[model samples]
Target: MSLKLGIHTGPQDLSMEELLRVWRRADEAGFHWASVWDHFYANPLNLREDPCFEGVASMAALAGATSNMRVGCLVFCALFRNPSLLAKAAVTIDHLSGGRAEIGIGAGWFEEEFREFGYDFPPLGQRFEQLEETLQIVRSLWRDPVTNFEGKYYRLPGAVGSPKPLNPNMRLWVGGNGPRRTPRLAAQYADGYNVPYQPPEVIRERLDALEQACERLGRDPAEIGTSVNLRFHMRAHAGDSDADPPDNYVPGSITGTAQQAIDRIGEYVETGVGGLNIAFRPPINWDAYEAFIEDVLPVFHTASA
Candidate 1:
């Protein structure tokens, strides 16, 4: 499939109604999907970020608001909830949105959120172990008749499903960057992989690793979706700053000119990205929304390998 373009929204905002306007505008702009961040506190992207709203709540609200839009979390913090319960919650949202939900999840990182919220922030290895179990349990729970799972981290006794996915299998997207475990989990359960704001070179390495994992597992890497989360826009000096992004941000994250920005995305596409999720932090900077919607996005859509 050719590349698709989408944007991210912060859940640490005022209310769903407030963010709903952004979603409606994105929908009106002819975008394919709307992704919201699932951070409990302000994330690394925020220059001086603060946690605003809850992730799943905004997801449920977004699912209810838009009819044509496909809504999902950019990457949910998976450590806070039980896998079976999280699966049920996703299933409920899927039913509410009439099957428009896609589960976007990751092994939780943000240490601040865990310490502040009183959740265990385990060592990296243990977290990956939990994430693996979570993905497995979610897949099992989505079965037509329901199933059982007894893993080191999760134990569901003949768990009955909540709302069976309308799509024979609910779409799963695992997000992260563990050279070994992450891609293996993706190969086993993910319909797609959601990568964070890593540089193209790093992204290429990660993709290679995933391909290796897929090969080991007898999976065709091409069959699994690959989506990159472009950290920030590169419109110009005076572009949107709804988000005060960081400097170490990747090349795609807020440094290039319009043409350069387009070129960078093209490079990523060439490197095997199936879709691009460009970040549009607002306050509407020097860059005009008209120019972006009218000029830039169209160029991205028509861009070919």
Candidate 2:
């Protein structure tokens, strides 16, 4: 199967102008997808309190701006908006993008953001329950003529989300790697599963779990696409003056020179990952982005073609 490549941008510390420039460039460069993260705060640990943009709103703007690249939030917190309303928003953005919209969602993490937003930070299990309900509600609103759902966390009485998504197969992506509920949930509900911030070994384990989930659910494993999200850091050469990696750099990021990035990404592809969502660390690293576009993307694109 062909590999799908995408750029994932964190909404923190970037102006709309910068975000547009990067995404538009990726679109013009023929990247398959472009994503923005959903967050009210800059980062979980950033004490500097950098500027952060709202995810869905940014996705709407991104949808309108890009012509070819698919636009979506990397993963919206399911608790951040009402399920039915989120369905409506997704539909709107899908129309704006002429059917190039993806819905990426996860159970809300980052407890502080929830508290500050006046949302209850419930236990993980309870949050998963909410996530499950949100998935069902959103899917129903998108596909069903009328939806009437009553769940522990959400309720919809004759909810009719209008102007349905332009794409009949609007992609619903579930992000995260919870050992039990998450994999099963994705098998049952999501069109795609994306595990972030993990190495190849961990990703292999999660994919195994996802396959098992699909088996238990009596669904075709091929029905659910698999992808990974990795942080990226690169430079023109090994000892270039501006080659220092980002301070927030964690282990397992796809880092190094152009050839190294090509090899590292290939490892995941070998493990049956069909897609990659890469977030480059600040200061945006156009040098790395340019190199990746020139040297790395073509390897996969040509293989696919």
Candidate 3:
């Protein structure tokens, strides 16, 4: 199946005018969507000292500014806002996009983002539990004109969220790779799954686990969207211990030529992934990204077409 190709909204500080300029280019370039990392920190991947940018709000700005590119968070943090409130915000952005928003979400992970912001950094298991509840509550808030849910962690005696999504079906993509709990949870609630940061072998293992989760739950893994995060670092080879990858050092992010990256996307497509949201190289690497878009995306687009 043909799928969307996109970029992450991290790296570099863009002025309001600059952000609009780049976003217009993204749309004009035929990218299917765009996304940004959710954080309150200044320098997670670099030492730029660019101030904090809220993700969902930026997404709304992008949605309003871009005519066709679907706007969304790379993965919105589950703990950052009340579940229902977040859902309402998403619906509003969806309206702005004319029904082209992807509601990607995940359990909060950055300790600094949490501790520094007065938010609790619950342990992973507990965080996952809260994430599960967050999904249920958010979806309910979107689907039900009014909802009353009383869970151990969240309570909504009366939940009224509207104006509902413009499209009859809204998409919710979840990001995670925990072999035990996350896949099953995605099967239960998420419309899509973002492959977590891992090596190719680890990705295969996680896909197997996701397949098993689907089988046990009587869900079709095919119906659940398949996606991955890719890094665009043309310099670092697989064996470079000294090479500092610009973004997350997820396995497979280190090094590749533009052609290698396209071939890798082919490999991912062969393994059933439907979309790839690439974290391009930093400001200095924009030339690399431009080369990639010119050389890689077209081949994949034509092949998959």
Q: How accurate is candidate 3 locally (lDDT)?
A: 0.73
Which residue pairs show backbone clashes in model 3? none
Tens digits of per-residue lDDT for model 2, 85-202: 8889999999989899988889978988889878899999898999999999999999998999999978888988788888888989899868778889999999989888788888
Off by over 4 Å in 2: 244-246, 302-305
Question: Across residues 104-195, which tens digit of lDDT does each residue of candidate 1 receive?
Answer: 77988888778877888899889888888888888888874767787888788888886687766567899876667788889888888878
The C-alpha TM-scores of every prediction are: 0.88, 0.95, 0.88
Query: TM-score of model 1 relative to the true fold?
Result: 0.88
lDDT of each candidate versus the true structure:
0.73, 0.84, 0.73
User: How high is the lDDT of residue 98 in model 3?
Assistant: 88
Q: Write the per-residue lDDT of candidate 3 for residues 5-74, one digit (tens) a residue.
A: 8766652365556566667777777777777767887545345366656887788888888887777776
What lDDT does candidate 1 reach at residue 41? 71
Q: Between candidates 1 and 2, name the one with more favorable lDDT.
A: 2
